[model samples]
Target: MNILMAIHIGAGLLALPAGTIAVAVRKGGRLHARAGTAFFGSMVVLGITAAILGPFREPEPLSPVAPLFVLYFVTTSWVAARRRDGSTGRFEILACAAALGTSAVMYWGVVMDGATTPAGPGVIYVLASVCLLAGLLDLNAILRSPLTPARRIARHLWRMCFAFFIATGSFFIGQQDILPAAWRGSPALLLLGFAPFAVMAFWLARVRLGKRLRASLQALPERKLA
Candidate 1:
């Protein structure tokens, strides 16, 4: 048990920096690919360990359920990156369904006894909301296949960043007690924790606009030729 816990923590620590580097570097380059690969591998390790260990935690069932959702999102987001336009696979459908079902269950738990839980219902509600939203987005993408390259990238970026956000939130805010006392509850820490989401949003807009400009530029020669 201790060994698994150590590995989970160690992998998570490695994943944080690797994921950050992946997000910062140029997209489609070898460096970005390698860093992103490393991040994904480390996250897989971290998620598996978390899911396995969660069930044994003092709180019993609820602990196990949380990590399962993490695994679901991480797996689906990774899959999204590899999918081509107009592709609709069984895995994607199943993953989206799992996300929706898990979110619903979490919400039910909140209604049942969330106030008595250590973390309270707020966290549960927030997580459920995001999972539900992500599931809906994934379903839309699947149903409306042949997504544009920019849109594909947008989906990949947001999903991966949201998964990254979960990791960051877990470490920075959820585990704040590990930090120096002065650093605890610092607004700076809060900003850093939420920075992934901001970056994701920036890139989402950037990719959409950049793709539109490139497409427009490409069409100009055809317009002139015609």
Candidate 2:
């Protein structure tokens, strides 16, 4: 248990910085790719460890399904990025099922059991809602098949950004006790915790709403023929 805790903490520490670097650097650049890869690796370890350790925590054990949420987002995002041809596969189907199942479990815990997560019911509700929405989006994409480049990029961007948000929130807000007493409950900490959402929104708009970006994405298929 101690060893698992150590590994989990270590992965979280690594993930926080790696995810920040991935978000900070220019997208599709070598630095961004390397940082994103590092972040993905660290998050996989963190998620696995957290899921395993959650059930054993003292006083009140955590719901293991929570960590799986991060895992689902990161994994699906990675797949979306890798499938440059905008193809869908069985994995997306499996991921959709996982997301829906997770949402159901979370909703049941909060509504039926009257259980609150460590961060409270509000966070759980938000997480559950996002999971449900993601699942629906997954189904839509699968049914639509061969997504547009812009849509695929949008999918990858939001999920990865959301995963980063989770990591940032866990560290900046959830672990505020590790900071100096003066910094505790500081507004700066709150901003840092939520900064990823701002970044995500900016990039999503760029991908989805920008005319130039849409044009470039549309040109991708034609360029391949030459």
Candidate 3:
């Protein structure tokens, strides 16, 4: 493999399990923090290397867009975690703007491929749409002012999970050829690819429903006193 490809795979290897560990452990703990930092750092390197190598594949012009999308997602997601207080900073605004710009490029690519080229979207549509949605959400949060703690956590959780999903999908599904024959078509492989999404759904539900239920229960005694 070329140097860029090699670096991309190497960084992906580090990110895979580190991201998993970060998600599985208790949030805010030292272990989680360290693992998360490692995962984020690995993703940054992987995205950059992939972006570098993508354009070199002359026949596949759309190849470079995916890496740019990944970088945008990962960067914004990391920033969401940092801005826990719902405060908007320059970095957050810039990240959102970048994501929106990337989405526009992806949209143009897909349209051109469908209308003139043979590529026909090739996942760019879905990727671009996701970036668009995330960008809009980020912008909305910023414009609306301070986000609630729950909203902040929800944003952080979904964005991180989506970024992890991209990594898992690329490594486990896209690179399945490297796996042993027995493992290649296994259901376990499917689960591994989709586990990030499942976890994201569960956490989102908990943040919305579970927390609200707990808050109601805590307020019940005060209501009775009144």
Candidate 4:
């Protein structure tokens, strides 16, 4: 395993964080809107780069999963952004449900594979569901009240950030097959990516749930985030 390569790749992915922090610095400000464009642009660049080089660089399911995640992120991000008209339509609900259900299943899968993933995937799955449910409810509330508060938008921003964090972690773990067998169990070397793939799956589920949960909380009188 090229330890340097893994670190380099993971660190490079942090650009997404930079863009995210910028827009989420204070939701709804002109600067926030401007930074958001940059954040999306940066992610697009990262996704495209990963896609074009990912297949040759990494083999099997991991490579494909990366691109697929990118596509999902892009499409969903678009829906999340453009669908900001405050109306949660059938498509939105369908997409959220599918994403949430998938996360739930994935989490259960990891939990079943306890040998490799002791933490289980359900944690992530439930988290993603929370976000999704919250987002839906919040969207409805916003439609009625027509206001996306700073903290609320920041929570939304963090939800995506967390998702990206999980994806980046997966990229490292999924590449394990490429690592030297000796390096596989090297604590210092592999600690960061020891369970790369399962972690990603977990995060994917959590982030999606967070999306829904945020909506749910938004709609509630308490106005909290899950």
Candidate 5:
């Protein structure tokens, strides 16, 4: 692995654990904001590196997954920034579609093609698509409801976290040694490839659940919603 590539992968690889810790100390505070900026910056750099370094073995259109991912991140980030009044639902749909589309194509290649040994890439694609959809649905629900401060904040948090979370997951799975000695020819692993993703999902969920539990318990039971 190129030294720079390894560092890029390492930065993203560590962002989840570090982000989780920052959120635990300060869920929606200045520290979280700082962490968020760092995480997103790393993602942006990752995306750029992806497109530039995407494997060219695949055909022209299919070979551009890196640039396509970059486009996906940039477009969705713009949409979230301007999605006032829920007018930018199209962006979410397209992003999720792009995610699923790329994933499906990679799926065909990984499962059918003879080149990939570790199945991590295909698994990463599928899981990222699913997380993207879940986060999108959460935003959709928030849009339908009466927009309270709590709801708005949750919406923003989910949007940001899911995008970066899954982005980080795929980057790491692709770069790091996601395979064992057994699976040497294909990109498929014996279910261990899902470990990083499980960790990411747990971290994200833990951040939300821990905060809610703390706030709920502090309300002295009677005043807090069960």
Candidate 6:
């Protein structure tokens, strides 16, 4: 358990800076690619370790399953970015099923034991909605087959950004006890924790609204435009 905790903490620490770099750097560049890779790797480790450690967190019964959300988003985003052809396969079906199942579980938890759930009913409902939406989107993508370049990029960007948001929120807000006393409850910390949403919005806008940018992205090779 101690080993899992250490690994989880270490992965979270690594993910913070790596995700920051990935978001800040110019997209499609070598630096961005490297940072994104590091972020993805760290997040995978972090999610796995967190899931392993969650059962021991006596007060947070939902802890064990929560990490699966991040894992799903990260894995799907990575797949979207790498698969230039935008093809969907059995993996998409499985992910969609998992997401819907997760949503069902969350809803059941809130309906059955809302008071004891650590996230409360509101947050759990919102999360469940997100899972439902994601599952629907996955179903759409699977049915559509061979998504357009813009759609592919949009999918990757949103999922990856959301995953980063989870990581940031978990650390800068959820783990405030590790910070200095002066930093606790600081507005700056709050902004930092939620910054990824802003960044994600910006990128999604650029990808969807900027016609020239879309053309450029489509023209670039997969290796160059992740």
Per-residue lDDT of 168 in model 4: 43
User: Pairing residues by index, what is the TM-score of model 3?
Assistant: 0.88
RMSD of each: 3.4, 5.3, 3.0, 10.8, 7.7, 6.5
1-226 per-residue lDDT for model 6 (tens digits):
8888889989999999999999899988999999999999999999998888887876644466669888999999999988899998999999999999988988888889663355546888888999999999999999998999989999999999999999999989998999999999999999999999999999999889898877879999777565
lDDT of 5 at 3: 62
- Encode model 5's per-residue lDDT on 19-46: one tens digit a residue: 4554455655677657666666666666
Cα-based lDDT at residue 170, candidate 6: 91
Q: In model 6, which regions exceed 4 Å deviation? A: 58-62, 112-116, 212-226
In model 2, the Cα lDDT at residue 65 comes to: 74
- For residues 1-226, what per-residue lDDT tens digits would candidate 3 score against the true structure? 3877888888999999999999999988999999989988998998888878876766655365667767777777787788767787787788778878888877886677552335445566777788889889978888875888788888888888888998998877877899987789788888899899999999899887898899889878654554
- In the range 151-197, model 1's lDDT, one tens digit per residue, is 77788788788778878888888889999999999998888889898
Cα lDDT for residue 77, model 2? 97
> What digit string (tens of lDDT, one per residue) describes model 2 on residues 1-226?
8998899999898998898898888999999999999999989998999999988888888777768878998999999999999999999999999888888988998999997866678988988899999999999999988999989999999999999888989888989999999999999999999999999999888878896866779878654565
Task: Please report, as a residue range, the 10-residue window in candidate 6 with the lowest summed lDDT.
Answer: 113-122
| Each prediction's whole-model lDDT (CA) | 0.81, 0.90, 0.82, 0.50, 0.53, 0.90
lDDT of 2: 0.90
Error of 1 at 145 (Å): 1.4
Q: In candidate 1, residue 171 scores what lDDT?
A: 89
Number of clashing pairs per prediction, in order: 1, 0, 0, 33, 10, 0
Off by over 4 Å in 5: 1-22, 56-226
Off by over 4 Å in 1: 58-62, 112-116, 213-226
TM per candidate comes to: 0.86, 0.89, 0.88, 0.44, 0.49, 0.89
| Candidate 5: residue 192 Cα off by (Å) | 12
Alpha-carbon deviation at 102 in model 6, angstroms:
1.4
The lDDT, on a scale of 0 to 1, for candidate 1 is: 0.81
Q: Name the weakest run of 10 consecutive residues (lDDT summed) in model 4.
A: 58-67
